[model samples]
Target: MLRYILHKLALIVPTVIGITIASFAFIRLLPGDPILAMAGQHGITPERYEILKEQYGFNQPVWVQYFDYVWGVLQGDFGISVATKRPVLTEFLTLFPATVELALVAMIIAVAMGIPAGIFAAVKRGSWFDQLTMGVALTGYSMPIFWWGLLLIIFFSGYLGWTPVSGRIALNFFLKPITGFMTIDSLLYGNWPAFVSALRYLILPSIALATIPLAVIARQTRSAMLEVLGEEYVRTARAKGLSPRRVVGLHAFRNALIPVVTTIGLQIGTLMAGAILTETIFSWPGIGKWMIDSISKRDYVVVQSGLLLIALIVMAVNLIVDVLYAVINPRIRVQ
Candidate 1:
């Protein structure tokens, strides 16, 4: 188990390096000059532009820039965000927890509802529940996130007027951000109003973000459950007079969870990235929205650093998922 974990951890270094190189190249190749974008309506003279380039080291060869960037990254420096004039790492860290909170809430909703819906659907097979759940899952999987989010806003926020349309918490609360997660910080500060406000603000976006993952989890769970239900162990459990519930829950569900967990784990990265669209639609303040804003301004440092960090996050999630295989099935640990 230790060796397996070490091996997986070792793999992340090269993966992150590759991601950095690709991200660096892509950001540099993007249309528009960061310097001009920063200059805004105050156009610079040719001499001024050249001075600015030299000042920001834009005049350096691409390879030298890349090497400097990598060296800085190695020393835990992600450079300054041209948009905020703050350290890219600090900016990311500040915004990241909100994304984590949103993603976690979304994942919780997906797993809580999806897995059981799938189990029931599999158990019933040809019943109405199965049909309804599968149909919903299919719709969810096929639906575009932006349209779904807007429709939800129209119905829930506009027509029904039940929830806020945007932001992490009500502006009135003004809870100082300790963890960057509104809900957690609210609890820490003993702010019930803020906590409730955060949850209300969170509902629409979390649902929007969760839609695809829920559909995927439900479908994967149903498939895995169906396969496991047909296995010899399940049949033996049933033959030995195990109750239907025990046979399904204890024998089948446990076996089926491997793939479901994998889907959930893999979805973490997608959820984080997908938060960009959802956050934009809902006006949620998170790294995704921040990145989008940075992209619009052609803030090269922020974009490159953000992509590299996101890639690192994805790789880390994958590593954690790999470790979970040992817990899900002892056979993996043995191997």
Candidate 2:
């Protein structure tokens, strides 16, 4: 297991390096210059432009710039935000946990809702419950996130006025960034008002984010369960006088989980990247929101850093799935 993990992690290093190179190159190659982007070059002089370039090391050769970027990364320097003038890493770190918390909440809802619906559908193959659950799942799968967010805002926030319209918390709640997750941090600090506010705000975005993945996971889990529930072991468990529930739950569900877990983990990575649209709609302060802001402003440093962080997250999730597979299936254990 250790050997397999080490080998997988080693592969991730070069993958991240490649991602870093590609991100750096692509952001630099975008239509506008970062200096012009920051300076808003309406009436800039040559001397001033040169000074900005020299100051930001934009005048450095391509090779030198690459080395500098990489070396700065190695030393934990992700550079200052070209837009905000804040340290990119610090700025990102401040907001990243919120994204992670949101993603986790969405994943929880996805798994909780998807897996049971899937199992029930598989268990009753062609019943009313099956049809209803699958239909709902399909509708969820088809709903566009932005449209869904708007609908949620219109009904839940606009008409009902039961929840806050936008943002991570209500105006009256005092924020204490304990773990950077507003909900969790609020709880830790004994701030019930903030906790409730954060949770209520969390629901619409979490549900919207969960839509496609919940459907995908439900479908995959149903298929995998359908196949596994008919396997010889499941039949044997039934023949040995095991309850139908045990046969399905213990024998079939366990094996079916491998693929479902894989889908869930992959979906997690997608949520991390895809949250940009969702965050924008809801005005959430997360990595997604920051990435969008950086892009609009052409903040090269923040853009590059944010992209690299996303790449790292995707790779890290894959690595976690790989390790989990080895742990669950024993056959993949390193000799």
lDDT of 1 by residue, 250-303 (tens): 999998988998999989987987899999999998999999999999998999
For model 2, residues 64-154, the per-residue Cα lDDT tens digits are 9888988998898999887788899899889989898888998898899899999999999999999998898899888888899899999
Which candidate achieves the best lDDT against the true structure?
1
User: TM-score of every model?
Assistant: 0.97, 0.94
lDDT of 2 at 53: 88
Candidate 1 residue-pair clash tally: 0
Stretches of candidate 1 off by over 4 Å are none
lDDT of 1 at 314: 82
Maximum-TM-score candidate: 1
